[model samples]
Target: MNATSGAPVNAPAELHDRPIGDLIRDARNLSAAEVEKVLSYQREHGVRFGEAAITLGLASPDDVLNALAQQFHYPLANAERRLASPELVTLLQPFSVQAEAIRAVRSQVTMRLGQGEAARQALAVISPASGDGKTYFAANLAVSLAQLGGRTLIIDADLRGPRQHEVFKVSNSAGLSTLLSGRAENQLIQTVEGVSGLFVLPCGPIPPNPLELIERPAFALLIRELSTKFDHVVIDTAAASLGADACVVAARCGAALVLTRKNENKISALQDLVASLAGSSAQLLGAVVNEF
Candidate 1:
């Protein structure tokens, strides 16, 4: 009949600063094995109930909501709505193999560029030819960077054949081309919904002279502008061996990720592309082995 004995358990404050395992242990009052199950659930669904509890330094749902509202300028009920939203939940999915590979490349590039210089602004993902999985790699890589808490922008620079929208299953109605033409810069820069810290500039309608658009001084200026707004601006460029577009984009990028497939032609093509870019100032950060 004791009130305290029958009361529900509450999470500890300052949970965010604590190790995830420790937070889980404290919150659920469970054994290590049981806590791991909850951790697994959080990773799969992108729902970090224990982590959120810690992040907001709260012991109960109401306290968490109140803390977020007070610190983040969000209304208490609105904060609760957002926290319970499925979109927010999905953002918590654990990193996949593809994300890890992309992270490896990002780390290599950052090391080569050195902390301040390399991490300065923009990064690009390209290949020697089509079907090398450049777009897929770029999309996953951008998501990876976002997961690491960096604001990322994935630019679809493949004007000849824009595929990023299709990869992310997002719209392509208004994008880079539209922005360039002075149509809708504001509208074209699409915020990737549900995925925090990630935005996309899809390649709108294909232009007849993609090379011309890429080479213009305005294009370089555009790159610079985008770089300022995001921690990492990853461009999915056309295959270098296919045309001059990728090279132009590469020149402006801080570094490029060269992708190669397992087949002999693709490997040989990648080598040739590297040789071609060797003369320029653009640095080939490293080659990614695709489908291997």
Candidate 2:
């Protein structure tokens, strides 16, 4: 008898289109009897399969979530690798909670500018301070946009503490800094290794004067050229409090996403950062509370 339907289940058909209970059972996370118990509770109370499994204490929240992801055909990330905070969710585990959060952020950003418009070109990801995870959010957001089939470029504009080059695992030998100084031309922008439709413009050599480099007119030209080349360009900026770099970049990008961390971030610091951005030409798309 079928564990979910209580009918004789066909193996091939069940493999393709089984109910959540059967899918969870097939994952071998729960025994057949346990699955039947969960199904019984689900049918009686009209609760979701994952919720029912969690309520009955048959599965941990993550186990039920993995089972649910299996049912929906969304692949999970490889847990062994040392992927950065947001990289796993955006690149490998599109079905996970973290990935969903990134997507929600994407939707909010899109809604602000309306998708497929020139106004949506570049977005600078900024934060009140360093620990707010702005770089992680920017990297993941760019990957999510690429997953939507747009040609997306992530610029490591945080020259003071550049990370996108390391995040994408590419060489930072020649990028935005070199381009601005006329050391390199269009050849520096490199396509990210694994992700399709995703490119990275790493902050080249750490300059002695980071703010002076961004103030150049060539910096504005670089953004203008990238806007024409990519469907979306995401700039990772330095923490707003550290220096004027983020505000300068944001002013040129014309839009920004502010990231805040729970319990770890200070409200007064965030307010000060917001005050600074108020003077920039960039529109504040929205704020994201990153739990990770």
Candidate 3:
């Protein structure tokens, strides 16, 4: 007789709605060796008796595996496991220079952090004006932090015109705004696959008042929470002189990585930004002069 023809016909039906473990325990008459083989097959290909159960309208294999993975902190393979896009990886390779820059900045912050203080530090990347490699610097800095064995989180806080998700070719359907609105945390946060220890919180849908949103208590709380979770929190703020959002972020950030192109107009803007932040509490960690 077939496997199903021999069982108490309604037995599988009763266990159908039960948990996978319960179903496994109650489905008697199946030998221990046979049960182990079924389990092994399931683990290797995510199929076998579980799928048969579901196919026969008994239980859901997907849900069971998901629950078990979540309960055990099992690292499930996801889109992030795919290798970084060739073009994007090539573009970021030059950022090896930024790795050194970040080390220097990290030293300064470490000295300032002293003992007994929380290691929650924030860093912002700002430029004299647009198109000065600020985002590139920020992205590279994040990668650098991950390379150093730190859990790094990069936030595209440029609400006015966010680009982090686009640069990484990821979805921006949900992010900081969704989190601020009290949505599920997993929905807004995504781990950058392939790059171990690097996470990104894309600037979801841009709101009308980017400055107002950044200044909200929710924003501060989010930053604090994220800082605690990651070893490094790098925020890509808008150009310092071009938007109010940048200034607000600058005021809250522990340090600012100023970017200035090697040019007269940009240098002038950088000078102005330096003067503007000179008296402010935000530490001017250092500046990066981007060539072309």
- Give the candidate number with the greatest lDDT: 2
| Top model number, TM-score | 2
Residue by residue across 219-280, what tens digits does model 2's lDDT show?
A: 98878787877888999998877798988998889898888999988999888878888867
lDDT of 3 by residue, 2-117 (tens): 01125665554432345555444343334666556656666777765656445444445544453343334332333242244332331233234444555565566556554333
**Pairs of residues at least 3 apart in sequence or in different chains that clash in candidate 1:** 15-54, 16-54, 46-92
Provide the overall lDDT of each model, using Cα atoms, as 2-decimal numbers.
0.67, 0.78, 0.65
- Model 3 regions lying over 4 Å from their true place: 1-119, 181-186
TM-score to native of every candidate shown = 0.67, 0.71, 0.63
Error of 2 at 149 (Å): 0.4
Worst 10 residues of 3 by lDDT: 86-95
Candidate 1, number of clashes: 3
Which stretch of 10 consecutive residues in model 2 shows the poorest summed lDDT? 1-10
Q: By TM-score, is 1 or 3 better?
A: 1
Show model 2 residue runs off by greater than 4 Å: 1-86
Between candidates 1 and 3, the one scoring higher on lDDT is 1
Residue clash pairs of candidate 3? 80-193
Name the candidate, 1 or 2, with the larger lDDT value: 2
